[model samples]
Target: MADLIFYTNPQSRGQTVRWMLEEVGAPYDTEILGYGTSMKEEPYLSVNPMGKVPAIRHKGKVVTEVAAICCYLADAFPEARLAPPTSDRADYYRWIFFTSGPIEAAFSNKAAGWEPTPERQRMFGYGNYDLAINTLEKALTGREYIAADHFTAADLFVGANVNFMLAFNLLEPREVFVDYARRMTDRDAYRRAQEIDGRLIAEMQAQQAPQPA
Candidate 1:
């Protein structure tokens, strides 16, 4: 078995980690789990009690959460150059966590039709969907990369969100966001990861389709 094991569902946020893994050029094994089934039962739960997809077990250590997995892989495979040097990781840590926290929270809340009132904005880290998205747009305005001059794992996480949000109409099609997402996803690694997941999704959908009696 490969030292790196990736547990994921193709339709889930696991796609982001899949891109990161391809960028790292590591030989990892993928375990496709279904929602509310294997993902919520047995040994998978032990790996991540949250019963989430996109968990990675590297060597012996297990890392869950999408952003965390991306960061871990970058550090674990320095040769991939997916992370800036430890001393030069100010923006790296900044943007990655920002996306993981406030941005994600804002998007999720917005999708669920629950935007906080202006008076209660202070109580929420993201304030509101517009506030969070505008911040991200400004950060990427003139930058080709989120964390450094070159691509990093931060881009993978942030870009995946941007791409997904834009695709689903969850985010407005702002010029800056569109340009940044294009640059981040215009990579061989990203394409390969998407193809893998796309095929998996198709297979899963076919299996779930009602049979023609």
Candidate 2:
């Protein structure tokens, strides 16, 4: 068995971690779990009691949450250069946490048809969707990558969120966002990850389809 074991469902946010794994270029085993079955049942639940997809167990250590998993994998396999040097990780930590926190909260709330009122904005970290998105747009306005001059684990997390939001119409298709997502996802690793998940999704659908009598 590989030292790294990935637990995921192709239709979930697990796709982001899958891309990160491909980028890290490490051999890992995958365990696919269904929505409310194995994902919530034994063994898998022990890995992540939240019953969430996209968790990873590396050398007996378990890491959940998409951003943390990506960060862990990058640092665990430094030869992949997925993280900037520790001395130069200001933006790296900044953007990754920002995306996972504010960006995530803002979009998720917006998707659920709940936006904080102006008077209650102070109670929310992102303030509002426009505010959060505009800040993100500026971060990527003139840069090809988010943290370092080159692609890092931050880009994988941030880019994956951006691409997902845009795909679901949760985010606007601004030129900057469109261009940045294109650049981040253009890598061979990203393509390979998508192909793998795409195939898995197809197979799952095939199984769920009813057979004609």
Candidate 3:
């Protein structure tokens, strides 16, 4: 048996995990689930009550959520050097959760056209899209990686979000975002994951298309 069992959908946040998996170079089996059917039914549900993609079962333990999965995998595969050293983990953890929380909320709110008032913005983790964007840009400015001048699982999540946001127009096109996207997407592992997921998405779309008359 492979050390890990990855349950994901190519069209979902699973793309992030796929890149991390490749970066870690761990042995894992991927089970692609379809929307509304396999993903919402049992077996998969037992793995994640939320019925979310990008869940992993490793050593009979289940880990769900993209950031959690990336952090877990990095720790699981110590030799991969995907996690920062113990003493240097502040930036690693900081950026990972920052991407997952504030950045995610900011972009999502913008995409949904849900702008919050200044008073209410205080309650929101991101404050607003501009604040979130500026914070992230400042972090990435003049840096190749988010933490410790090297690539870690934190970079994987940040890179994935930037690439996804820019591609879908979910975020504005800032020089920081564009440069970071170019640098992150240029990785061999990221490219490999994209090709695999792109092919899978294409296959799914082809199957869903109507048959020729």
Q: What does candidate 2's lDDT look like per residue over 25-122, in tens digits?
A: 99999999999899999989889999889899999999999999998998999999999999999999999999999999999999999999999999
Ranking by lDDT: 2, 1, 3
Highest TM-score against the true fold, candidate: 2
Q: Give per-residue CA lDDT, model 1, range 29-126, as digits (tens).
A: 99999998999998899999998898999998999999899999999999999999999999999999999999999999989999999999999999
Off by over 4 Å in 1: none
- Global lDDT of each candidate: 0.93, 0.95, 0.91
| CA shift of 162, model 3, Å | 0.8
Q: TM-score of model 1 relative to the true fold?
A: 0.97
How would you encode candidate 3's per-residue C-alpha lDDT over 25-50 as one tens digit per residue?
87789999988999999988999888
Q: Rank the candidates by TM-score, best first.
A: 2, 1, 3
Supply candidate 2's per-residue lDDT for 94: 97
**Window of ten residues with lowest summed lDDT in model 1:** 140-149
Q: Model 2 off-target regions past 4 Å?
A: none
Best by lDDT: 2
TM-score of 3: 0.96
Question: lDDT for model 2, on a 0 to 1 scale?
Answer: 0.95
